[model samples]
Target: MLPPLSEKELDRLEDLLITYGNDYSVLNLAELNGFFTALASSPTTVMPEQWLPAVAGGKVPKFKKPAHEEAYTALMLRYASQVAEELGDDVDHFEPLFEESEGEEGSVIIMEEWCFGYMRGTQVAGWAELPPEQDQLLKAISLHGLEDNFELLDQMSEADIQACVPQVTEAARRLYRYHRLQD
Candidate 1:
């Protein structure tokens, strides 16, 4: 099995992404984690060719060196593979790579980018209308990820948002398990 990305490698990958030209909509590390998780857990396979462009904000970036491009691709594939292995080994322990910030109460999770990435993964996979239960699970993710729900989220209190955290986490796990069962 391929090894997971080390912390240094992850930082390097993040650096590469940040430097990938201002014109491109490259995903940050958190979003990339979410995107890869979604793809790994997707009911159907999404080819790298299809999702790779999506990661670069819908267009592939031009690297100064072919070696740089190769390295970038390799890092991404390895990270995605790591996510898949984690999920495959045990969905129950799967954790989203969410960022956290100090709030008045404590550390608050910043799930927006991750959720958005997951939603993008679903889009890339061309997910069809799911059954009611599965759709509900997907909705848990969309509630936090999609900008369209900003107004709704705005009205929610911090406590409410916090409450949704476990729901979102469980939703991801259940979604993965649900799809795996079908396989």
Candidate 2:
């Protein structure tokens, strides 16, 4: 079984985000905060070269000194799944309504000047993703600054993960948004 990624092993992910993430990601708070904790200690385990999936064709994209959208999204999906298991099956569906809105952005010009889908209505498609209010379901996460496992943070024992719920949703949504890349 793949070991639960140690705090250190998971850290390489932060570095990867900074090196290959985009502008939107650079502004994220989760990456910055998470990286800080990881740096506090040395890796109890060594990071294998294959730790991360090969950057297809080795054409790695350049990002800022922090994680961006992709990292955020991955974080969320993971949290959602984990939380679902912990909270029981009923909670998973409301964990986060991850959706994709790429070319569809600005498709609805609400006042001809203000749009909705970019971030505002991203959660509305199937529903929205807002943070700070965890009645569950955060689709277009306004909780952007988070990079820990938030889903079960409040309920877990002290030794549990930090649950970056917003990031998890973003990653799930992004996968669908960029599905064409796979084609």
TM agreement with the true structure for every prediction: 0.94, 0.26
Model 2 residue 135 lDDT score: 20
Q: Candidate 1 — which residues are off by over 4 angstroms? A: 21-24
> Over 4 Å off in model 2, which ranges?
26-183
1-183 in candidate 2: lDDT tens per residue?
A: 122334653465445555555543321223332222111111122121221212211323443434554663454334323422322333223223222223343322111001111122222122222233322323223333233424534475432221444444443333322321221
Give candidate 1's whole-model lDDT. Answer: 0.86
Candidate 2 local distance difference test against the native: 0.30
What is the C-alpha lDDT profile of model 1 across 1-183, one tens digit per residue?
898899999998988888883543555888888888888878799889998888898888999899889889999889889988999998888889888999999999988878988898888888888899999999999999898999999999999998988888888888888877662
- Superposed Cα deviation of residue 32, candidate 2 (Å): 10
Q: Residue 35 in candidate 2 has what lDDT?
A: 21
Which candidate comes out best when scored by TM-score?
1
